[model samples]
Target: MKVTLDIDPGHTQDEIIIRCAELNDDLLKIVALANSSQKKVVGSLGKQTFLLEPGDVYYFECVDDKVFIYTKSKIYDCALRLYEIEEKFQGTNFLRANKSTIINLAKVRSLNPILNGKIEVELENGEKQIISRQYAPALKEKLGLGR
Candidate 1:
């Protein structure tokens, strides 16, 4: 689908207009996302809990048993398990880079195929995540790069 964004200073409020020939699953999800009022994930740094926008999150990492939300400037502890986070961010730009990590595809800078059959994903923040060989095919399919 071709997406266009128009920024007009004359408009009073931000609005979304979808022009499609037919309604399909992808269009339905797009409408659902647009109609949803809020999409947030809670993360904490010490006692102060912050509501973080899922879009700002670079990726989620599971170290040991804890899940941490990584952003451009800070790391916050998340209460959701890796799988739970996976389910919540479904249909969005989030993709499972590995068993222990969920990466936001919007933050991806590049994908490089490595010598060991794994894919190296470089994030916009310069941090790299490895997409295991087991999940590499799925990643390629999602990006429409697979045959």
Candidate 2:
């Protein structure tokens, strides 16, 4: 695949041209990443009350029927649900590690396999989360490892 970026000074906008002889998983991943970055999240608290930044978030979790964004400093309630947040952050280094958790791969420091088909994920901040076996395959795939 070949990617070409065309700049038009008069138009004040840039154009992207992707020339590929065949489409594969890599191409799909690139497209997904580009689309995910365009998604915006609106906080439930208030428009100006909380702004969610991808880098600042360690993970998104649904607990007690409420969605929360976990950051290094604090956690904020999100207007969107777990599934919604998962879709919005897809291809952005965030993966659904469990039923109620969407973890940032960039924030994961290490993974350890535990008993009964569960894996423990240790984040850079020393926080640990359990990744159910059902979602373990997906997490392994995202990490570029085979299950």
Candidate 3:
């Protein structure tokens, strides 16, 4: 793989251009990652609202009826629904681990195949979550691991 960076003094915002003869899985992943929005997300802790970057979020989980975003040490209430969050972060690092949880693949440290065709995933923060049998294939595929 070859990488080249061109600096344009007149350009206001930075831009990336990829020149490839054919798009492969790795190239597609690069495009997905590069195309992910840099827009900040709003989450509230108690009564105070906070702006969060996507990379800082470890995962998003729904409990009962409320959705929360988890970082390494903090959890904040999110205004979006599970599916809405899922749709917004599509093609990025987020993956649906189960019906109620979306995980950030960037924060995953390890994966262990458990019984019942499930997968036990450990995040960078040492928190663990299980990938349901139905969703395991998608997670595996996203990670470039065979289902």
Query: Using TM-score as the measure, which candidate wins?
Result: 3
lDDT of each: 0.87, 0.80, 0.90
TM-scores of all predicted structures: 0.80, 0.82, 0.91
Q: On residues 22-96, what C-alpha lDDT tens digit does candidate 1 reach at each position?
A: 888789678756643267989999999999987799999999999999999999999999999888777777789
Off by more than 4 A, model 3 = none
lDDT of 3 by residue, 1-147 (tens): 899987879899988888989989889888877766565668999999999988999999999999999998899999999999888888899999998999999999999999999999999999999999999989878877865
List the candidate numbers ranked by lDDT, top first: 3, 1, 2
Report the Cα lDDT for candidate 3.
0.90
Runs of candidate 1 with Cα error greater than 4 angstroms are: 1-21, 24-29, 32-37
lDDT of 2 at 108: 95
Scored by lDDT, model 2 comes in at 0.80
Report residue 143 deviation for candidate 1 (angstroms).
1.3
lDDT of each residue in 50-136, candidate 2, tens digit only: 656677789888999998888887777887889888877767788888888998888999999999878899999999999898988
Worst 10-residue lDDT window, candidate 1: 29-38
For residue 7, what is the lDDT in candidate 2?
A: 59
